[model samples]
Target: MDRIRRRRTGAVAGTLTALALAVTGLFAGGTGTAAADTRAVPQHAVTGYWQNFDNGAQVQKLGDVQDDYDIIAVAFADATGTPGQVTFNLDSAGLGGYTVDQFKADIKAKQAAGKSVIISVGGEKGAVAVDDAASASAFADSVYALMREYGFDGVDIDLENGLDSTYMTQALKSLAGKAGSGLVLTMAPQTIDMQSPSNEYFKTALAVKDILTVVNMQYYNSGSMLGCDGKVYSQGTVDFLTGLACIQLENGLAPSQVGIGVPASPQAAGGGYVFPDVVNNALDCLAKGTGCGSFKPSKTYPDIRGAMTWSTNWDAGAGSAWSKAVGPHVHDLP
Candidate 1:
């Protein structure tokens, strides 16, 4: 299988809605307009991707998503014909006739329940590019527009193709300026993209560290990588999760800003699928220095953000086993 054929199985049309320039002074700051009312993410949270197109996994409306998932990332916002522009098309027909108005209402319901619904851009086949300043502006403007149109709390950068740290950092900062402090910025860089602080993805994470909510690096599809201790660890093991996470914790990311992302099931990725117990063990090892494999961190990160999965739909297909086990564990972390 191709490395880039991991998540997002089908394509959806990019439909950009015309956003009104109307501003309501509901809150302060952010470009002289009221900021978005983004819900506060938990100290230790669970993030899951909600698939837009049916791909054998469970097809769900935004409201039907389980409460265990603190952050519901709507997967694969399509890259538009314009450079760096993206738009979301709800697969109403494919999703059993789910409509745009219903989708927006569901997003509001999630937020009211203290869950964040963010638009995830870029996947295995994602080709959205923000390489230059002009494209960077377009990217930020379009994403912010989506946030307003769809009632999204923020944006998730899952661009697998490639990224320019300089412009991405600028784009995110510009977005935060418009969205205000409530912006919930998150990322899902591949394991290789974050092996070192010098890498583009890592650089962008560090650049926007203050505004960044979490960097849930996809710990699957990554065969083997060097840990912060400079030891090579293979995937599908506790060492792979804890060891690789140490790199981010030790390098620049705060304990609260680092998260371990794993596949929801064996079918979720090409490889690197660990059971819920293994994920729990990794979390324990990182947070409290217990349940570890061979490699262990020099220090414990009690405030480590938490865990994430490729999708919630897969967990539902498996009777919600992933979230049923991992969700409480993440919330119960000390």
Candidate 2:
């Protein structure tokens, strides 16, 4: 998969017309199924992005991904001619000729197993931006339509180049209105994106903290970033993971809202991929205050959501080494 490099990178009900959506708050009237959002936003969770293309990595159906992965984020949905205008470009040829309906059926199978599958936007080369209200609305409408069309549980924001906090917030708020209860909103910002609370991505996540599910900051393909202790930490270390994650946990996000994002293997990213055991050590140091590697969180985040990886395809290539080793560790986190 040729992903855009800055890093990486939902639906609704009727009676949920735009007008009615406007008046309702984010968590307004939701059915039992809407509770899907709450469960989808899991604790001690393991998330993996599935490449829509073959990319030399194993291509598995949505329902065939490892059982330990709680959330499976589909690689990307392209933004069309206009800013925020978007459409999915699933290459049936690349997908082993899996038809759209087959893909949709697989998505339903995943949901039946209690896993949340969502569409991820942006990659190393993704072109998506929400600079104003109109663009924001276009983003909301287009993404919502994809959710309804594909039976997706939500959307993941992985815009690598840049983002507009203000309008992106507007678009998400509008999207939440449309998605109502089951809406799952997640984010995958680069290491620098979370170095401070004021950065565009950080601001956007904080702005929608109420409706936001999780913010999985990509810790791979990054060189160095400022930790919560106001010092810089290089990648590929537990300090790098927990310290940067501390910025979000202490700044505003609940423990459950922050997840440590990394690459499944060195081949999965340009740089900064650590061994699975190292990833688990970082999780332990953060969630339980043990396994410290130089820098430790001032306080443990027992409720930290868990970990996220760049691509599940790469994990399969490694004989599922990454998920096999890390998934159970994340699940056993304090």
- On TM-score, the leading prediction is 1
What TM-score goes with each of the models?
0.89, 0.89
Give residue 190's error in model 2 in angstroms: 0.6
Highest lDDT against the true fold, candidate? 1
Task: Give lDDT tens digits, candidate 1, residues 1-334.
Answer: 1122364222111110110111111112211111222456988999999988888888889888889999989996888999989998889998999999999999999999999999999887778899889889999999999999998989999998789999999899999999988999889998877876778999999888878888899988766666666566778899989988887777777788888999888877878889999999999999999999998877788888899997888888888899999999999999
Flag regions of model 2 displaced more than 4 Å.
Answer: 1-37
What lDDT does the true structure give each of the candidates?
0.83, 0.78
Deviation from native of the Cα of residue 273 in model 2, angstroms: 0.6
lDDT tens digits, residue span 185-272, model 2: 8899887677656679989988888887788888877666566665557788888888778777776787778888888877777777
Total backbone collisions for each predicted model: 0, 5
